[model samples]
Target: MTTRMAAPMSVTTESLAPSRSTETACFHCGLPVPPDAPYAVVIDGRRQPMCCHGCEAVAEAIVAAGLTDFYHHRTTLSRRPEDLIPESLRGLELYDRPDLQKSFVRVDGEHTREAALILEGIVCAACVWLNERHVNALPGVLEFRVNYSTHRARLCWDERQI
Candidate 1:
């Protein structure tokens, strides 16, 4: 009589292990966050995220002491949502005037022209990235950099195309 060998168990191991945790880094202290350890607060019409209540309180104290730059620098570096601007409804022509002339100073003709734009309502890097992407899509824009602290964007473009 031939003996029947028992079939090997096909048990999957994934069900036995714990589920992966979703964690975000704290904006202020750079700690791993399990929940909403980083609390978002609105200041100067801009939403900012802090690591904890202590950091938030410290931020408030700094603002109360008129140290606005402290907050501005910190908030600018943090990952936050951009303040949406209705570009279609706004007059972009205002930025094209002689006073706001698009010009660049280059020692050699080999260099391209650079222009600085002061964006009024920019709040985060996403806005900067979006604007940069759109502007770069234009025929002549070569490169651009956004300074969140100053809410400004510097663009380099070919003069012939502009």
Candidate 2:
């Protein structure tokens, strides 16, 4: 049987928040934020708009850590969602453990398994792309896809590879 799972997002750095005069991009990932976008948060005394819930969550996580200064100190754009991830998700190795995988994984068929994960800090389309690439690179991973709207990842892998 096929099973479902969660996924992650990506982020970028910028010097300042966009002014209200034009379309505003997400403060963290630079994705265009619609004026009516509901995902937003206050950071460093400024309210910032986010392109998606994942971006908003990442921004809030950063702010909560007293690391709002990261925006100013970032020397390069974050290449993966993992880069912007807070302390809660510092290690990616948890997924490699059988005990942890049991809760998220299910039998898809003979020699196949599926897992779902909710990636809370995704910030952009590139984040999803990077996550898929990263997960698919795993030796057992046969396919990996992340839904940006739900922050969920659906991973299919060879059971024997575990």
Q: State the lDDT of candidate 2 residue by residue for 4-91, as single tens digits.
A: 3322223333444434447777877775787789988886566777787767767787777766667666665444375668887677
Q: Candidate 2, 114: how far from true, in Å? A: 0.3
Give the top-scoring candidate (TM-score): 2
**What's the residue-level lDDT of 102 in candidate 1?**
34
Query: Model 1 segments beyond 4 Å from truth?
Result: 1-111
lDDT tens digits, residue span 7-118, model 1 = 3223221232224445444434344444645565454545545557654655566555655454334423333222244667467667656555635333225546767667
Which residue window of length 10 is worst by lDDT in model 2? 4-13
List the global CA lDDT of all models: 0.56, 0.74
Q: How badly does each model clash, as a count of residue pairs?
A: 0, 10
Off by over 4 Å in 2: 1-102
Note the residue pairs that clash in candidate 1: none
lDDT of 2: 0.74
Clashing pairs in 2: 5-116, 5-117, 6-116, 6-117, 6-152, 6-153, 7-152, 7-153, 9-122, 10-127
Cα miss at 118, model 2 (Å)? 0.3
